[model samples]
Target: MDDLARLVATEDVRRVMARYVYSADHHRWDDLAALFLPDAPFIASTVDGSVQARMTGRDDIAGQLKARNHPDSVLVHHLFSSEIDFESEDSATGVWAMEDIVTRPAGEPAGMHGYGHYRVRFTRLDGRWLIAELRITRLRLDWTY
Candidate 1:
Protein backbone atom coordinates (compact mmCIF):
# COMPACT_ATOMS: atom_id res chain seq x y z
CA MET A 1 0.00 0.00 0.00
CA ASP A 2 1.20 3.49 -0.74
CA ASP A 3 1.41 6.17 1.97
CA LEU A 4 -1.93 7.61 0.97
CA ALA A 5 -3.70 4.28 1.06
CA ARG A 6 -2.10 3.41 4.36
CA LEU A 7 -3.22 6.71 5.81
CA VAL A 8 -6.80 6.07 4.80
CA ALA A 9 -6.73 2.56 6.14
CA THR A 10 -5.38 3.78 9.47
CA GLU A 11 -8.17 6.28 9.77
CA ASP A 12 -10.70 3.62 9.02
CA VAL A 13 -9.28 1.40 11.72
CA ARG A 14 -9.44 4.25 14.19
CA ARG A 15 -13.02 4.89 13.26
CA VAL A 16 -13.95 1.31 14.07
CA MET A 17 -12.30 1.63 17.46
CA ALA A 18 -14.11 4.86 18.12
CA ARG A 19 -17.34 3.12 17.30
CA TYR A 20 -16.45 0.34 19.68
CA VAL A 21 -15.90 2.80 22.48
CA TYR A 22 -19.17 4.49 21.78
CA SER A 23 -21.19 1.32 21.62
CA ALA A 24 -19.63 -0.07 24.74
CA ASP A 25 -20.10 3.09 26.72
CA HIS A 26 -23.65 3.33 25.56
CA HIS A 27 -24.33 -0.34 26.26
CA ARG A 28 -25.21 -1.06 22.67
CA TRP A 29 -24.12 -4.66 22.74
CA ASP A 30 -25.12 -5.65 19.26
CA ASP A 31 -23.51 -2.68 17.68
CA LEU A 32 -20.30 -3.48 19.54
CA ALA A 33 -20.44 -7.06 18.30
CA ALA A 34 -20.86 -5.95 14.72
CA LEU A 35 -17.45 -4.32 14.80
CA PHE A 36 -15.71 -7.68 14.95
CA LEU A 37 -15.51 -10.60 12.64
CA PRO A 38 -17.92 -13.37 13.43
CA ASP A 39 -15.13 -15.61 14.65
CA ALA A 40 -12.99 -12.98 16.22
CA PRO A 41 -11.49 -13.38 19.67
CA PHE A 42 -11.38 -10.92 22.52
CA ILE A 43 -8.68 -11.51 25.13
CA ALA A 44 -7.88 -9.63 28.27
CA SER A 45 -4.91 -10.24 30.50
CA THR A 46 -2.23 -8.77 32.67
CA VAL A 47 1.16 -7.81 31.34
CA ASP A 48 2.71 -11.01 32.70
CA GLY A 49 0.32 -13.14 30.64
CA SER A 50 -2.09 -14.19 33.33
CA VAL A 51 -5.27 -14.28 31.34
CA GLN A 52 -8.27 -12.70 32.98
CA ALA A 53 -10.94 -13.50 30.45
CA ARG A 54 -11.19 -14.72 26.88
CA MET A 55 -14.20 -14.77 24.61
CA THR A 56 -14.33 -16.16 21.11
CA GLY A 57 -16.60 -15.12 18.28
CA ARG A 58 -18.69 -12.02 18.14
CA ASP A 59 -21.85 -13.43 19.65
CA ASP A 60 -20.06 -14.89 22.62
CA ILE A 61 -18.17 -11.68 23.15
CA ALA A 62 -21.31 -9.62 23.10
CA GLY A 63 -23.33 -11.96 25.26
CA GLN A 64 -20.76 -12.37 27.97
CA LEU A 65 -20.09 -8.67 28.16
CA LYS A 66 -23.75 -7.87 28.24
CA ALA A 67 -24.37 -10.31 31.05
CA ARG A 68 -21.49 -9.04 33.08
CA ASN A 69 -22.14 -5.36 32.54
CA HIS A 70 -24.84 -4.32 34.95
CA PRO A 71 -27.51 -2.05 33.56
CA ASP A 72 -26.56 0.81 35.87
CA SER A 73 -22.85 0.38 35.48
CA VAL A 74 -20.76 3.17 34.15
CA LEU A 75 -17.87 2.53 31.81
CA VAL A 76 -15.64 4.83 29.92
CA HIS A 77 -12.67 4.22 27.66
CA HIS A 78 -10.15 6.62 26.22
CA LEU A 79 -7.96 5.55 23.32
CA PHE A 80 -5.12 7.47 21.79
CA SER A 81 -1.59 7.24 20.47
CA SER A 82 -2.50 4.55 18.00
CA GLU A 83 0.16 2.92 15.90
CA ILE A 84 -1.23 1.18 12.85
CA ASP A 85 0.72 -0.57 10.13
CA PHE A 86 -0.67 -2.31 7.12
CA GLU A 87 0.54 -5.82 6.50
CA SER A 88 -1.33 -6.04 3.24
CA GLU A 89 -4.08 -4.22 1.43
CA ASP A 90 -6.71 -5.99 3.49
CA SER A 91 -4.87 -6.71 6.74
CA ALA A 92 -3.18 -4.62 9.41
CA THR A 93 -1.84 -4.65 12.97
CA GLY A 94 -2.27 -1.91 15.51
CA VAL A 95 -1.55 -0.87 19.07
CA TRP A 96 -3.58 1.72 20.94
CA ALA A 97 -2.90 3.26 24.33
CA MET A 98 -5.99 3.20 26.50
CA GLU A 99 -7.21 4.21 29.91
CA ASP A 100 -10.53 3.08 31.22
CA ILE A 101 -12.84 3.37 34.20
CA VAL A 102 -15.67 1.11 35.22
CA THR A 103 -17.99 1.84 38.08
CA ARG A 104 -20.43 -0.68 39.40
CA PRO A 105 -23.99 0.15 40.31
CA ALA A 106 -24.85 1.45 43.75
CA GLY A 107 -24.62 -1.10 46.59
CA GLU A 108 -22.16 -3.28 44.69
CA PRO A 109 -18.44 -3.04 44.80
CA ALA A 110 -16.92 -0.48 42.48
CA GLY A 111 -15.27 -1.72 39.34
CA MET A 112 -11.87 -1.02 37.81
CA HIS A 113 -9.56 1.73 36.72
CA GLY A 114 -7.04 0.59 34.19
CA TYR A 115 -4.36 1.60 31.77
CA GLY A 116 -3.54 -0.75 28.95
CA HIS A 117 -2.52 -1.26 25.38
CA TYR A 118 -4.84 -2.87 22.89
CA ARG A 119 -3.01 -5.06 20.39
CA VAL A 120 -5.23 -5.93 17.49
CA ARG A 121 -5.35 -7.49 14.10
CA PHE A 122 -7.75 -5.89 11.65
CA THR A 123 -8.99 -7.18 8.32
CA ARG A 124 -11.00 -5.42 5.70
CA LEU A 125 -14.19 -7.35 5.13
CA ASP A 126 -17.15 -6.19 3.10
CA GLY A 127 -15.67 -2.77 2.47
CA ARG A 128 -14.86 -1.93 6.09
CA TRP A 129 -12.24 -2.94 8.61
CA LEU A 130 -13.26 -5.27 11.39
CA ILE A 131 -11.35 -6.59 14.33
CA ALA A 132 -10.14 -10.11 13.66
CA GLU A 133 -8.43 -10.46 17.02
CA LEU A 134 -8.12 -8.13 19.96
CA ARG A 135 -5.93 -8.43 23.02
CA ILE A 136 -5.78 -6.14 25.98
CA THR A 137 -2.75 -6.30 28.23
CA ARG A 138 -2.99 -4.04 31.18
CA LEU A 139 -0.04 -1.96 32.28
CA ARG A 140 -1.86 -1.02 35.45
CA LEU A 141 -5.11 -2.62 36.54
CA ASP A 142 -6.92 -1.84 39.77
CA TRP A 143 -10.15 -3.54 40.54
CA THR A 144 -12.49 -4.02 43.47
CA TYR A 145 -14.59 -6.77 41.98
Candidate 2:
Protein backbone atom coordinates (compact mmCIF):
# COMPACT_ATOMS: atom_id res chain seq x y z
CA MET A 1 0.00 0.00 0.00
CA ASP A 2 1.12 3.51 -0.65
CA ASP A 3 1.74 6.04 2.07
CA LEU A 4 -1.70 7.66 1.84
CA ALA A 5 -3.54 4.36 1.60
CA ARG A 6 -1.71 2.87 4.55
CA LEU A 7 -2.36 5.97 6.61
CA VAL A 8 -6.04 5.87 5.79
CA ALA A 9 -6.30 2.19 6.56
CA THR A 10 -4.59 2.67 9.91
CA GLU A 11 -6.96 5.47 10.80
CA ASP A 12 -9.94 3.40 9.80
CA VAL A 13 -8.74 0.53 11.95
CA ARG A 14 -8.43 2.82 14.95
CA ARG A 15 -11.97 4.07 14.45
CA VAL A 16 -13.21 0.49 14.36
CA MET A 17 -11.57 -0.18 17.72
CA ALA A 18 -13.00 2.98 19.23
CA ARG A 19 -16.49 2.12 18.05
CA TYR A 20 -16.40 -1.31 19.66
CA VAL A 21 -15.60 0.03 23.12
CA TYR A 22 -17.95 2.97 22.76
CA SER A 23 -20.89 0.87 21.68
CA ALA A 24 -20.41 -1.78 24.36
CA ASP A 25 -19.96 0.69 27.21
CA HIS A 26 -22.95 2.74 26.06
CA HIS A 27 -25.16 -0.29 25.33
CA ARG A 28 -25.67 0.72 21.74
CA TRP A 29 -26.34 -2.68 20.28
CA ASP A 30 -27.38 -1.49 16.85
CA ASP A 31 -24.35 0.70 16.49
CA LEU A 32 -22.07 -2.11 17.54
CA ALA A 33 -23.42 -4.35 14.84
CA ALA A 34 -22.28 -1.88 12.20
CA LEU A 35 -18.65 -2.38 13.16
CA PHE A 36 -18.46 -5.97 12.06
CA LEU A 37 -19.00 -7.98 8.91
CA PRO A 38 -22.35 -9.69 8.60
CA ASP A 39 -20.78 -13.03 9.31
CA ALA A 40 -18.05 -12.07 11.74
CA PRO A 41 -17.10 -14.28 14.63
CA PHE A 42 -16.94 -12.52 17.97
CA ILE A 43 -15.33 -14.20 20.91
CA ALA A 44 -15.16 -12.97 24.49
CA SER A 45 -13.73 -14.62 27.58
CA THR A 46 -12.48 -13.95 31.04
CA VAL A 47 -8.80 -14.17 31.87
CA ASP A 48 -9.71 -16.01 35.06
CA GLY A 49 -11.20 -18.80 32.90
CA SER A 50 -14.68 -18.45 34.32
CA VAL A 51 -16.39 -17.37 31.11
CA GLN A 52 -15.64 -18.21 27.52
CA ALA A 53 -18.28 -17.49 24.92
CA ARG A 54 -18.41 -17.22 21.17
CA MET A 55 -21.00 -15.66 18.95
CA THR A 56 -21.10 -15.77 15.17
CA GLY A 57 -22.64 -13.18 12.87
CA ARG A 58 -23.63 -9.61 13.61
CA ASP A 59 -27.17 -10.30 14.76
CA ASP A 60 -26.10 -12.88 17.27
CA ILE A 61 -23.42 -10.60 18.62
CA ALA A 62 -25.82 -7.74 19.33
CA GLY A 63 -28.47 -10.00 20.83
CA GLN A 64 -26.12 -11.99 23.03
CA LEU A 65 -24.17 -9.01 24.28
CA LYS A 66 -27.35 -7.07 25.07
CA ALA A 67 -28.65 -9.94 27.15
CA ARG A 68 -25.38 -10.33 29.03
CA ASN A 69 -24.85 -6.68 29.89
CA HIS A 70 -28.37 -5.33 30.27
CA PRO A 71 -28.52 -5.71 34.01
CA ASP A 72 -25.12 -4.19 34.62
CA SER A 73 -25.35 -0.87 36.39
CA VAL A 74 -22.16 0.54 34.96
CA LEU A 75 -19.82 -0.82 32.30
CA VAL A 76 -17.07 1.04 30.58
CA HIS A 77 -14.73 -0.55 27.99
CA HIS A 78 -11.68 1.58 27.37
CA LEU A 79 -9.28 0.62 24.57
CA PHE A 80 -5.79 1.98 23.99
CA SER A 81 -2.54 1.49 22.03
CA SER A 82 -4.52 -0.20 19.26
CA GLU A 83 -1.89 -0.76 16.59
CA ILE A 84 -2.77 -2.65 13.43
CA ASP A 85 -0.46 -5.00 11.54
CA PHE A 86 -1.55 -5.28 7.95
CA GLU A 87 -0.73 -7.95 5.42
CA SER A 88 -2.36 -5.86 2.73
CA GLU A 89 -4.98 -3.21 2.23
CA ASP A 90 -7.66 -5.85 2.61
CA SER A 91 -6.47 -7.51 5.84
CA ALA A 92 -5.01 -6.53 9.18
CA THR A 93 -4.91 -7.51 12.84
CA GLY A 94 -4.73 -5.37 15.95
CA VAL A 95 -4.01 -5.79 19.63
CA TRP A 96 -5.82 -3.45 21.94
CA ALA A 97 -4.90 -3.39 25.62
CA MET A 98 -8.19 -2.66 27.27
CA GLU A 99 -9.22 -1.65 30.78
CA ASP A 100 -12.85 -2.28 31.60
CA ILE A 101 -14.75 -1.48 34.77
CA VAL A 102 -18.14 -2.87 35.63
CA THR A 103 -20.32 -1.80 38.53
CA ARG A 104 -23.39 -3.72 39.55
CA PRO A 105 -26.27 -1.64 40.82
CA ALA A 106 -28.20 -4.66 42.08
CA GLY A 107 -25.60 -5.07 44.78
CA GLU A 108 -24.01 -8.24 43.55
CA PRO A 109 -21.09 -9.69 45.49
CA ALA A 110 -18.72 -8.94 42.63
CA GLY A 111 -18.99 -5.19 43.31
CA MET A 112 -17.28 -2.68 41.02
CA HIS A 113 -14.59 -4.45 39.01
CA GLY A 114 -11.96 -4.04 36.30
CA TYR A 115 -10.59 -6.44 33.70
CA GLY A 116 -8.10 -6.25 30.80
CA HIS A 117 -6.96 -6.88 27.18
CA TYR A 118 -8.79 -7.22 23.84
CA ARG A 119 -6.97 -8.84 20.96
CA VAL A 120 -8.70 -8.22 17.65
CA ARG A 121 -8.48 -8.92 13.93
CA PHE A 122 -9.74 -6.69 11.17
CA THR A 123 -10.63 -7.35 7.54
CA ARG A 124 -11.47 -4.84 4.89
CA LEU A 125 -14.62 -5.79 3.04
CA ASP A 126 -16.23 -3.88 0.18
CA GLY A 127 -14.10 -0.86 1.02
CA ARG A 128 -14.95 -0.83 4.71
CA TRP A 129 -13.13 -2.13 7.75
CA LEU A 130 -14.80 -4.71 9.96
CA ILE A 131 -13.80 -6.79 12.96
CA ALA A 132 -13.49 -10.36 11.67
CA GLU A 133 -12.55 -11.92 14.99
CA LEU A 134 -12.11 -10.79 18.58
CA ARG A 135 -10.71 -12.35 21.71
CA ILE A 136 -11.02 -10.71 25.09
CA THR A 137 -8.49 -11.68 27.71
CA ARG A 138 -8.47 -10.47 31.26
CA LEU A 139 -5.06 -9.59 32.62
CA ARG A 140 -6.44 -8.81 36.04
CA LEU A 141 -9.79 -9.08 37.75
CA ASP A 142 -10.47 -6.54 40.46
CA TRP A 143 -13.03 -8.85 42.04
CA THR A 144 -10.22 -11.19 42.95
CA TYR A 145 -7.68 -8.50 43.73
- What TM-score does model 1 achieve against the real structure? 0.94
Write the residue-wise lDDT of candidate 2 on 4-98 in tens digits: 99889999999888887788788898799779888888876766666667888889998987776646557777777776788888999988888
lDDT of each residue in 9-86, candidate 1, tens digit only: 989999999999999899998899889999999999976779988999988999989988998999999998999988
lDDT for model 1 comes to 0.91
My TM-score estimates for the predictions, one after another, are 0.94, 0.87
Please name the candidate that would achieve the greatest TM-score relative to the true structure.
1
Query: Deviation in angstroms for 126 in model 1?
Result: 2.1
In terms of lDDT, the best-performing candidate is 1
- What is the TM-score of candidate 2? 0.87
Q: What pairs collide in candidate 2? A: none
